[model samples]
Target chain A: MNWVWLHKWGSPKWFYALSGRYLPWLTITSVVLLTVGIVWGLFFAPPDYQQGNSFRIIYIHVPAAILAQSIYVMLAVAGAVGLIWKIKLADIALRQAAPIGVWMTVIALMTGSIWGKPTWGAYWVWDARLTSMLILLFLYLGVIALGQAITNRDNSARACAVLSLVGVVNIPIIKYSVEWWNTLHQSASFSFTQKPAMPTQMWFPLLLTVIGFYCYFGAMLFMRMRLEVLQRENGSQWSTTEIDRLIGEHK
Target chain B: MLFRQPSELVNPLAFFTLVGSLFPLALGTQPDFLRASAPGLLWVSALLAVLLSLEGLFRSDFDDGSLEQWIVSPNSLAILSLAKVSANWICTGLSLVVLAPVLALMLGLPGYCLPALMLSLLLGTPILSLIGAIGAALTVGLRRGGVLLALLILPLYVPVLILGCGAVEASLQGLPITAHILWLACLTVLAITLTPFAIGASLSISVTE
Candidate 1:
């Protein structure tokens, strides 16, 4: 396959222009998808026979949980690319993704806990998924903290890359161990999976919401990457000219 | 070679002893409580002792500019990194394994579980050193990386900690400790196979910065 497109995306100037064009589409589509999915999930989807309305939280919980895990995967994959190619844009993507991943993990935990309150009769049970997510949050915090602690930007990015990659290697092990530890302590919950044993009405909106979350992440990622490109390339001729063009358009 | 001298070994060993001894006083001399908690207590203490000494893992080398020298050496950095990790395990990890039973005994750990505790420590501590060395390498260039290093690595340490203490706990409960021990062994093997490259890469970034 011809590789011009790959190298073009790797370049900050091209990426900045392409992402700017996509940003408006990303923002409008994600916002619409999220609103429609949430509305469908909350009002139209049938409630659980056992859980009643509290199970509605799955709309938010599963998407955030999936996003949280996938974001970590993205961080590691991007970091590996950055390290291998010495791609500044990939490094920026890696650095930019950490805090968002942490927040998504936080949302998952919060919603999981709240849902637990009504369903499990307690807010927390040290459940396997929750515990695993907690550890992931810590891992994200570690990446973010390492970045902040180091003074040099390039060093910090590479360091964070190496650190997150290490964390990525351990991610599966952590999930497995936490899950094993959980089973040792308690019986398993009815986890939501792609082929979950639920009615179509119950699971359909969840599918929509999951897709919506991916769109949301894509939108946010491109927006942040654009800002990162401008900041890192502030003095470059292309970025300066682009900034002037934007200023002229606004004026 | 910095840790070859007896004095260098003594510092962490002494600190290890002091940490292990203080637990009984802080928690009181209740034998049942001590026995029940001994595995976790000793494991946590060992984990901390290893972490405490990790500061020295690359600090001296970085300060004296030897880290850069190693970075530019003709040989593979991953192997060199593994060599340092092996040295660290021998000095800190092996010492902790040796000291664990004494601490176990001090904590009134049951007689039957001593072998289990030793085996757990033997399998677990090396994984700690291997992974911990990655954090140490990442932070070696920073002026204040001690606590930051801990924050970065402790979450990753959870699996090994669980398995190590779980082995002893299983043995004490008259259950099969074999599975837990096996898990620890597998993790150590995985760490051995992979962590050196990670440490070497991080160290290259650190020293080159």
Candidate 2:
């Protein structure tokens, strides 16, 4: 089997070049989508009959929550790739993705609490989704803590990889068990397999924001990965030449 | 082998009992309140005690270099780590299970709940030991890993805590507890089959570093 394609993706230099070329486009797309989606969601979307304007928080809360969970899966997959292939880029991806996941989780929890106050008459409840999301926040903190505790870079990355993999396996079990433990909140409002109960006006911008959040995540990851790649590859000929060329262009 | 150091076995059991006693004192010995809160209180205490003991699970061997030798041996690291974790379960987890009845009585737990408590602890503590071993192995090389270990392992312990407490709660309400026990057993089996390799891999990383 041809291994060149695999090697190309694995190479830090190739990733650096490719990500650089597309970084501006990703940034522009994400900024535009996020702006348009948030503006439309906030102003144009009709208010809920029951909830009125409080439900506007769903646009941010839903996207952040979705991104929080999906980013974890991405972290685990990247970690697995690094472990199996020993790819430097995969390790960078795993590390860079974690802080972003943490922020997303925090945003989800904060917005959820804000949304909860007006809707549920309290800022917090032992609802299953809230509890699970809190646990996800802890899980993210654990990954970040473990990565920092170890002094060795490669060892830390691999250790976090094993941990995220274990966490991914446990995610389903945790979700179900927490659901069983208590479920005071309403059932899910959005699902891929089922048609949403709300009209398109309410959900369309939500869809846009979800996609926008993903693009934003990609842009963030690529930005962080590029900086990390340059840091790790410092003093190497290609990196030095790249730096010199950029400096020359700036001058 | 763990029995040689009696403190290793005794400390966690003592911690469990001490933690169990504090609840009644703080909550004012009201039997109804105690009875209602007994299941959750007992499980949380047991979980903390198990986490406390896990800090030392591999510390001695890791310090003395036996962990390195075991890794390099012809025998599989997974099996070797499994043996180590099993010894830990017997010393700390089993002792907690056996000692829980006295604590249950202190907390005014009903007689019918005792069997369910014992059964749940029996099935659930092993899962704690197995999963905690992975955290212990991961942090074996760090100088200050105790708090970090708890942070890493506690979130993973949520399902066990929920199921174990749920089993006892079910018995309290005269509900069928077979489902909770069955789920706990399934979690134990999954942990047994999967965590040993994680423990092995984590140990290799810690030892090599």
Candidate 3:
């Protein structure tokens, strides 16, 4: 019955301090997992019988793609929270998360294209998944562009929130329609879902990378949110004291 | 109001026709090639024409201060926003639908695909106007919102574009297009019911800022 913990998230000072404590641990976990996962997948896991060494790209491709989509959903949810509850931190989260989402989408698209050259025999094709991911990239760009175009911080956050909410509603419809259109064209040379299951060795590292990517995202988001909080709360007692202490410690 | 300002209707129709005609010239005048590409070409042109018309959807009102008046009025902003978008669809989308068959024929589309082309546009264009109105509302307060509006709105137009062109393409190949039509209808209905609230909310943000 205790909602007090939830309310604490509304306070930027509390979130910044709490996230500061957790950031080092999150960074350490993500760095370890990513290093282990990449090394294991690259060196130990068996190559695809069909794709050969090119299959290793899946370690990067799949996690980035997953994070890209997850970030969009998170952005939308955070936007909704800001809209409904007027939480400034949620607004910051929504704004700060977009550039990271854009990078994830770019990584996914680039790696997918690189992987495609060896596997699908072309760097690009109008495949359903590829097209939808491309659209997702545009959706993120739209959020970032909207945020930048409006000068007022509060207004920009609200506008971006509405845009992201509408986009989240449309993402499924866009994906389904793209898939249906692909079926009509009948040009799907390789389907990700139809691939046979991977061996335990291949997939275990993938699982690690996926979790690492999520932790990495959390650490990055918290870091960005803290910076934004400090900037927005500049000259406030807590931020001033924190900055003075950091300066004092440096001496 | 649209009739009084005939260019509002004429401009998008002209844009649609001009873009449709450019394809055959650029792609060569081969009838078969034109026919094959006509559905996508016409659909994309129509989409762009609707987008072009959307830039002005709230600009004049916002500048004239009527948009702020609508916010302060007793009537619901959602209904008023819906009415504005509907008027926009009538001026832009409806005109494109009615004008599409002429362009389709010119592009060498067979007689059989004509009905499906018109029907798909009839169902699809309203969704374009409704959704684009949200973008228009969001940017109505900006000085140079034209390019940003297109960037924001075009990605969202993908599904409607796919379904619209898919329906016509199916009919071109003598396949059953009922599924595409039904999906287009579903999108239209969903847009009709949902986008008004988004438009209303976005307009308030734009205006209040």
Q: Candidates' lDDT values, in order?
A: 0.88, 0.94, 0.92
Residue pairs in collision within model 1? none
lDDT of 3 by residue, A122-161 (tens): 8989988889999999999999999999999999999999
Each model's iRMS: 0.8, 0.4, 0.5
Candidate 3: residue pairs that collide: none
What DockQ score does model 3 reach against the true complex?
0.90
Q: Give all TM-scores, in the order shown.
A: 0.95, 0.98, 0.97
The better-scoring model by TM-score among 2 and 3 is: 2
Tens digits of per-residue lDDT for model 2, B96-190 = 98999999988888888899999999999999999999999999999999999999999999999999999999999899999999999999999
Which regions of candidate 2 are displaced past 4 Å? A1-6, A247-251
Clashes of 1: 0
lDDT of 2 at A200: 97
Which candidate tops DockQ?
Answer: 2
Tens digit per residue, CA lDDT, model 1, B1-209: 85567777777778888988888899998899988998888889889988887877999889999888898899888999899889878888898888888888888888899999999999998999889999999999898899899999999999998888889999999999999999999998999999989999999999878
In the range A1-251, model 2's lDDT, one tens digit per residue, is 99986678689899998888888988898898999999999999999999999999999999999999999999899999999989889889999999999999999999989999989999999989999999999999999999999999999999999999999999999999999999987887876678888999998888889889999999999999988998899999999998898789999
| Residue range with the least summed lDDT across 10 consecutive positions in model 1 chain B | B2-11
Model 1 residue B129 lDDT score = 89
Query: TM-score, chain A, per candidate?
Result: 0.93, 0.96, 0.94
